[model samples]
Target: MSGDPVAGVTAKTFGQLPDGREVELYLLVNANGLEMTVMSYGGTIVSLKVPDAQGNAEDVVLGFDSLEDYLSPAYRSANPYFGAIIGRYGNRIAGGQFEIDGTAYQVPTNDGENSLHGGDRGFDQRLWQVSAVDAKDGVGVVLSLVSEDGDQGYPGQLETQVRYTLTNDNALDIRYQATTNETTPINLTQHSYFNLEGEGGVEGQSGILDHILTLNAEAFTPVDEGLIPTGEIRSVEGTAFDFREPTPVGSRIDGDDQQLQRGKGYDHNFVLADNASDAKNGSDAEGLVLAARVEAPQSGRIMEVYTTEPGVQFYSGNFLDGSLVGKAGQPYEHRSGLALETQHFPDSPNQPDFPSTLLSAGETYKSHTRYEFSTR
Candidate 1:
């Protein structure tokens, strides 16, 4: 809170863990007064204040007000992922098993028969070292973490770094970089549930069903009963999965499609059509392609997602059944928030047709995704 309003970054103590480890919260404010708060604990994005058409600012992301709430048993059981960073493997790995160089490996399975978002205690549950950094056209913080070999049952000593920058043009740019001592699968993503209309609403009726969404994807990877991909990259044409145009999120969410039934909503990975090989490193802004766009008509807020990743997972907050209350002191009802996680496809290790997420020794993994905000 000690930085100037015209693009600055400041750090303050958020809270201390039960083990006496202190967590720091960094505030990054852009020139337009758009603010983002990130905490060292889990490298989580605590809050994002964005302005509506009327220039009124409000937090557009769903999260808890205090650290104790995040540590509660109920919260841990729900594992909504909130606004934390997912690593090792962002999405699911079938049966928590995979093979590399003919050597077999098995990770903890927390999601039914599949492994989800790393193990139970993934990057989202660990503390990161955070430092303020001066971005080219923004102010931000860099969070770094090192996972030892056999940590979370993954092979290799992985060194990872994530940068969150709030640019002057009201864009939150996220860049991920990692290097491993041995060959392993690495897919990282930011899991921030966004409502655009703000966190909680009247009588806990907040949901994202009214938001209009458009995905630059012609196909999607359908899932099985366990929500794991079926290895078939089916076309979305003439199906409920089609979002090529601006369509309401709830338009066909309740259809009789089996994919919708398995996911219970729009929780599928869309294969981006604008995949450019030159953009793999995400070093140049021109290399990024438009992935998805979400608009909240009620608030006149729009969020356009751009990324270099091959796929984007659109989760409509299916499991939030009013069991947990957010910072606004209101229960988070079903579909109260949504997540657009840009990364490689799910179960990539098992599906050879999907984009490869393998990171070999002496090679660095890089990815970038940007969320640009504006009013239509």
Candidate 2:
């Protein structure tokens, strides 16, 4: 066992809701002294402490200091999605409507005319039930929630469980599982804006645009002015979206590209390379392919994303306009942190060519994404 003061799983009362429900924070530490703090509210990752090349550890995830800040009036509107679980549907559903089993449904539209990240009140804003688990490789926590049939204009009573395991090898493993009593579409993803330079970067010390990024994707889904996918899997070749090679995030971020103008930055989904490539090499494990690899040059901090999801959304914190201050008591500015959300493609239900996100009553939906941290 680790000799750290916050080793294993420790729970503390974080805050209380308007209805008298108490929110809790679970702290998990590994033998290497890497710490992970998660809150019951939204199953949010409050902080993630990772080490630099010189063994200096710092919190690398962007988040608020207290539950009150997360519950403030501008929390949902002004703040970019940070360190929370996005769900029901992770991305946009065109027109906020879709047909499932010949029945048309309309969810709440929060992003213009499209339904974004579930709705006005997503799983990210909910209070989940938390429990500590003693797993085979490491200690972790499990957060579970139940969404009613008509809760978010979805036709199902869905039960979800998200397990966050911090392994001794410096990996934060996020596993998600869901079961529904009725037919519905389900896509859950973690929305943690990462700045490898640590919380200091989030405090406006530096921008994440200098981080080196590489995505194992040859194609990406293009979007319209409303930021909804245009039902096309366009090639990234000869385009700024190309990240098959390690490239500085700011190299072409300000180019005069229509897609870039639509998202205001990197806010599109990259379709991951097929698992068959790794399967042929006899290295495919649980179909977890390398989604993205990021490195902070100055800090020598690296984060590799491996997941079973088909696509990864690269959001460059375009909306953070220095209005809201973070835990480090500094305003989170634009391009301060980046989010690589691994999930099924956006508007999959509306796009027949895309992979399906449907989960029936008799079937179980399972997905896992691992964030492996190291100094390179």
Candidate 3:
């Protein structure tokens, strides 16, 4: 089962989807031989075994071992956001519709009459075809998916390619690239939650509200109960939203603010530095600066997120309850896990003030978000 950890890793099937369709899982062994598994289902990174400061390697993300784990309601091996490659449009569209060029497209409303994560059939639930599994590029497998112009209620036929590359330095680099044949909106991203201790579910793990975080932004978008933007980018000063420095998440989480209740916790979008464009043009500007830093003091593991995207969504996992057991035999509970999803602001298609998440013909939509790991 320890397929050459230092060379081209192999592909295998852990189980079959309920539809009797075969799902492929690719294991990318870094030059250092560390192992990271990627499943065609949702293009999810099921497991990533890497060495920590103690030289001990563990699976650092939340997930299950079987396809049934994802489809079954028993273990809750599902992550509405874990390691899934989301969307022609990633976040919510208020009222399940958005306008483009004087015309409106009626999208599917799966979340309280609003479209959430590209609706019930978002990219998270699809099985993409593998394009490249070159042990040569340290990319055990490159998964590609083509979204029909009208698939999932979005416009434009988009050819999307996501490359998951594991490095010898303990970094899982995700590169997203896409090009549309028609004028359409695009906001693609990977929804991977990091627990650092290699456990899933929110149980066993302590609160990350105390985890120090640093974001390079002064403003953020507040949301309503549906977690949809209210068309305002408020400043983080004197509020719990500020992460300009490494601060405790619990410090202001309980603020009686309306946005807090809307998110049920800390589900808000931070407006990253305007330099996101400079970085996209491949200029020398610091495009992917330190967006956030999290430390599991007890475990001595530190995680830093960097990206060229315009905003980062800091979710405290306010909804997770101890009902689901993780791979390491731990039940995940509320606030036990934290997700720092980097991307453009949610509800961008409707928010005229937020940065554009649109893509035109002949223009390539490229986004790169890096999760760097190290010791205290």
* Number of the predicted model whose lDDT against the real structure is largest: 1
lDDT of 1 by residue, 1-376 (tens): 2443556898889899999999998889887789989999999999999998898788999998888888899999999989999988999999999999999999999998889999988999999999998788989899999999998899999999999999989999999999898988999999999998888753433489889999999999999998889999999999998999999998889889989989999889999998723323223334588999999988889999999888999999999999999988878889999999998899999988787888888788888899999997
Alpha-carbon lDDT of model 3: 0.75
In order of appearance, the predictions have TM-scores of 0.96, 0.95, 0.91
Q: List candidate 2 segments past 4 Å from native.
A: 1-3, 202-206, 275-285
Candidate no. 2 TM-score:
0.95
Q: Write the per-residue lDDT of candidate 3 for residues 278-298, one digit (tens) a residue.
A: 433112233566677887655
- The whole-model C-alpha lDDT of candidate 2 against the native structure comes to 0.88
Please write out the lDDT profile of model 2 over residues 305-344, one tens digit for every residue.
9998888999998998888888887678888899999988
Segments in model 3 whose C-alpha atoms lie over 4 Å from true places: 1-4, 74-79, 133-137, 200-207, 274-286
Model 2 error, position 342 (Å)? 0.2
| RMSD to the hidden true structure, all candidates | 2.2, 3.1, 3.0
Clashes of each: 0, 0, 10
Better of 1 and 3 by TM-score: 1
* lDDT, candidate 1, at 39: 90
In candidate 2, how many Å is residue 98 off?
Answer: 0.3
Report residue 258 deviation for candidate 1 (angstroms): 0.8
